[model samples]
Target: MTRCRLCGSAALVSVVDLGATPPCESFLAADQLDEPEPAYPLHLRVCTDCWLAQIPPLITPEETFTQYAYFSSYSTSWVEHARTFVADAVQRVGLGPDAFVVEVASNDGYLLKHVVDRGIRCLGIEPSVNVGAAARDAGVPTLTAFLDPATGSDVRAEHGPADLVVANNVYAHIPDVVGFTRGLRALVADDGWVSIEVQHLLTLIEENQYDTIYHEHFQYYTVASATRALAAGGLALVDVELLPTHGGSIRLWARPAEAAGEPSRGVADVLAREKAAGLQELSGYTEFSARVAKVRRDLLRFLIEVAERGETVVGYGAPGKGNTLLNHCGIRPDLLPYTVDRNPYKHGRFTPGTRIPILPPEQIAADRPDYVLVLPWNLRAELVEQLSFVHDWGGRLVFPIPELSIVEVAS
Candidate 1:
């Protein structure tokens, strides 16, 4: 039985089955043309007792994240996002020259750069060689290893406990939930705080975001389930804040068990909402698998109908979520001629499993396809604005999941 990673509950039900898929980030090199790619079961389940949503176990972190190709500095919006986060966190946490801040999975020191400018000491724990080297180049002291208990102890022994630990969008990627949280407890100072951002499960279900499933992301977290996992590792949830980044996410502020403070109203409000919505009930999960199946049918029907009409359809954003959606819906190059990506690294490559070609955004303007499928629907507003020139050709943008709709751009 595939039990819950945190609570080990056997009362688990399959929520969404995305079929077999390779790790979304594992883009192939041109030279290795004949190299076989391995695909694993992309099935998701929800634990009734803990309400933790997770995928079936397959690959380990060491196999997935080492020498990673992604760099946080690639996105202009993301860089600005990091800058704002650093400024707000430094002020809100009251961090200064004497205080130390530690960031886990701190890819390329995206957030630490602003902290360093303020003359505050900051340490980054990054597993990817390319990203770690970038951080080091930026003069940010970074340890090139996964944040586990032993590494946490080593960091504390050398630099002492940190005043603030920032773990942005990493809580969902960890397979060893217990060990990772315990490491946080080991590294945080008595009065220090740990701020973590995770994509909320409630938003995922409500918005029909089944595309977020992939091997690299092991778990989908709700605030209630996260609290259970963290408290199990001797941490207390002090506050929660909703953010518009990454579709929809919840930023949680927690401290070691000894720190006493009134819990934020957002925390209790979300917890009660989840319970009232039947997140704690098994039937809530059992019904979700059916919804996922409907999404697959609807998307495939829409794509095939568009293709049959002899209308050209191309995809936008070669994101990880897009990979899952494309592969699961059995969409091949025959349906989506090619996809566009802002990341230079992915532009020339093909998406994993689906093998759909990726091109630059300029290709979209050049081709002027009849319909442009916005795969990363979360960023539709931003993307539509950037690609507004499609209006000149009378091209309409199509969003598949949550619902299939076309929005005509103003000419």
Candidate 2:
């Protein structure tokens, strides 16, 4: 993009360009395989003035999220993560029976269900009608709409201001960073807390998580840049927590400027780490593109070698990040055959650009594949446990990110 989406500066710097790919989650049905699928340039740029790493808004959330393919409840570990977060948040934020919690982008009520169990009134504001319907079916009150400034104010007006606003893994999804942040402010009480979890730019660069860069994720954030973005909406960041979910992420604790005091030591500590990594400038990012290229090269070489041996390599998850890797590496079904996923929405569908068939997880065990590439490598521990049955057939699991590694599983 010519100017920063957040800062309106023209000093955007290149990070890594993964050429072009279709919208990550746009799985095509078997009938549409013969039709043409569109692709867009997937380039990430960091605004020099604001230091916010972003991709041009080539695709909007409405295109991808309206009939979303992903359901958070499908992941056993992620559900537990949400349960733990709810329990911890109740204690940390002092949420009680009378308290009100609101979750933006609440998928299938995975997290808010915990709030309901505790008798704390909560509402989920979600854009996808299907998933939002699922949330309501689970007895979690939900509004089917995207979170913007006006929607937030209307929610506040109707349901009253929230005591704790939880927006996990969604801060990067919106192109209008300022408007989204302001929506967050409008949903929360003047003294209420706003908790946001996003993939930290620090870990994304350091860990070689380039696949996380897709059209839907408008920007990446370091603590320093996120703090500036929060200020635009009059929300003051007060504390920060490093999280292990989604490769690596940061949970930002914020409040209205009137109530927010000095930021916690963790904020300064993270900013220091970001600065030390040279993210504030262009030096830390210079080697990323080359490293990303290495990942693509190494993975292709391994897949090719496996194919030459007549060994089968199938994918384990149809995650969006997996599509980025699949498209970037130019891997087709020949290199890696049909993949499997626990999400039923992807079943019988094909991945966007690569056109690999998506099957049920049971297909892997049924076929007894030699190796199953775990696309959602961030869930290594949990997936290893779930796929341990692969050991019964002498099958191994492959993780393609942060370098390619094959692991043996024991039953």
Candidate 3:
């Protein structure tokens, strides 16, 4: 039995079993295709003790991140999201040129570049060599190492405790939630805050966001579980904000527990909301696997129906979430054919387990497939706007998760 990573509770209830899957981010080179790829059980369990939903750590961080294929700058929408956050953070935190900012898992400096542009002292901790080098080239000082107490202390000693430590969307990727929160506590000044954004577990279950679960992501959090994990590291959750990014996420602002301050009403409101949603009970999680199974069946039926009619179907965005969906559903290139992506690094490569060819976006126009399966369904609006040219050939777009449906573009 796998103990809960946060509370060490052996009483774990199964949420959803995605079967065996390779590392979602492991996009393959043509040369490596002939070699056999290994896969591990992509199972999820919720802790009855802390209500933390997590996957077992079957792979190391080095295997997933050291030479990572993902770069944050590739997503324009995400960059703009970062820009907006930095601007808000500067004003809200009363940041000035003298203030120090540190972003953990700061992929490719997409966010930190804006910090530098503002003339504030900034540093980035990114584990991926490829993305870290890109961050440096973009003028953000970066250290390519995993964030832990030792690394955090070294950074604190050199740069002094940060006024604002940004850890957006990276908190879920960590396996040692306690150690990571401790690192956050160590890196921030007494008066400073550590801002963490993670996909809300309520949103994941309610919205059927199973695709977001991959080997790289270790845990999904509710405000309650996050509060417990933070408290263990002497950090206090002072505020919380719900964000639309990643389907639905909560941006938590925390400070050292030794600091004096009352948590904002937002924190209490969210905790109450989670309770109302039945997150505090195991029955709330029992039905999720049924919903996930239905989605898999529905997606397969859609693809098979399209193929039987002798129509073509391709995909857009070769994201890690997309890979999870494809591999879990057993959809291979023969059924969906090739997919397109904006990241040139992924071009000409194949997805990890399914081996779907990742091509340039131009492929969509060339083949003009009857249906384009949008893998990153969260960006459905932006992608629909960008790929509106599909209408020229009467080609339509489809999303598999949350339900299989054709997109209705505004005229």
Candidate 4:
């Protein structure tokens, strides 16, 4: 009996099976082309007791994040997002030179750069060796290790309790959610706040974002589910905000249980809305499998039709989400000639399961195709604007999920 990672619930139901797939970000070098890739069953299950959505257990953080290649600084939009977040957080939290800010999973110090510029003391806890080294190179003091209860205590001992702890897009990736939250409680100051950003599970189901399911993402969280989980670890949700980044996400502000602050209206409203929408009910997830099946069929049909017409089609963003979507749809180089990535580590490599080569964004300009499939559809607007130059050839952009749509760029 596989127990739910969040609430220790044994009543779990298998929702959707994405078949065997390689790790989403495990791009292969050209020389390592013949090396056999290990694939695992990409099965999704929902905890009937707590309503937590998760993938079947397989990989650990040590197996996944060590020697990771992803760098947050690669994306111009992400960098801008971090800058804006730091500015807003400083204003809201009244952080100053005396306050110490800690960031968990601070990839390449993309967000902490803004914090450090203000003369405020900051520390970053990152597990990936390559990305952690990059953060250190950027002059951000980062500890290259996972944030657990023991590490958190060590950080508090060395730097004192943190006044602010920022965890952006790391909440969903943690396998031991409760342990991580406990670690946050131990590291944060009495009046400190911890802000976490995660892809909202409600939005994932409603928006047909099944592509985000990968082994690395252990849980898909809702505000209600998250509140319950946090409360169990002596944390309370103080504020919540819906963010447009990462398809649809929620930024949760939490503090120690002793902090006497009223919960934000957004938190209550979202919880009520989720309850009204039956997110807390078991039937909500029971119906999701059929919706996912339709998406797979529609995406495959569109791609097949485009190929049948002899039209060239390529993908954008060699992200983990893209790998899951492509592999689930059984897309290969024969269908998608190649993919473009901004990250240098992935640029010359091939996507794990599909074996589609990843090249620089310049490839899209040099070899103009009839259609560009935007894989990271959540960043469609940003990507479309960035690749608007594709319009010179009268090419159209295609988005697979939430239905297929082709739009001509305004040149």
Among these predictions, the greatest lDDT belongs to: 2
Residue 281 of candidate 1: its Cα lDDT?
A: 80
Candidate 4 stretches with Cα past 4 Å from truth are none
Scanning candidate 1 in windows of ten residues, the lowest lDDT window is 282-291
Give the C-alpha lDDT of model 1. Answer: 0.85
- The TM-score values for the models, in the order shown, are 0.95, 0.99, 0.98, 0.97
lDDT by candidate, in order shown: 0.85, 0.93, 0.92, 0.89
| Backbone clashes counted, model 2 | 0
Best-to-worst order by lDDT is 2, 3, 4, 1
lDDT of 2: 0.93
The segments of candidate 1 whose C-alpha lies over 4 angstroms from its true place after superposition are none
Shift of residue 11 alpha carbon in model 3, Å? 1.0
Put down candidate 3 lDDT per residue, 1-411, tens digits, no spaces.
479988888989889999999999999999999999999999999999999999999998888899988888887789999999999999989999899999999999999999999999999999999999999999999999999988899999988999999999899998888998989988999888889999999999999999999998999999999999999888999999999998999999998998838999999999999998899998788899999999999999999999999999999999999989999999998898899999999998999989889999998898888999999899877888998999888889898879888975543
Candidate closer to the true structure by TM-score (higher is better), 1 or 3:
3
lDDT of 3 at 382: 83
Comparing 3 with 4 on TM-score, the higher-scoring candidate is: 3
lDDT of 2 at 281: 89
Candidate 3 structure, TM-score to reference: 0.98
Tens-place lDDT digits, model 1, residues 1-411: 368888988988878777799898877666554789899998888887888889876988888789776787866667787889888888888987899999999999988988898999989999998889999999988999998888888999999999999999788888999899999888899899999998888878777788887888999988889998889878899999887777788899999988937888889998887777777786556566777778788878988898899889898888888898888889999999899888787877888888888899899888989999998787776777877889999999988767678889875
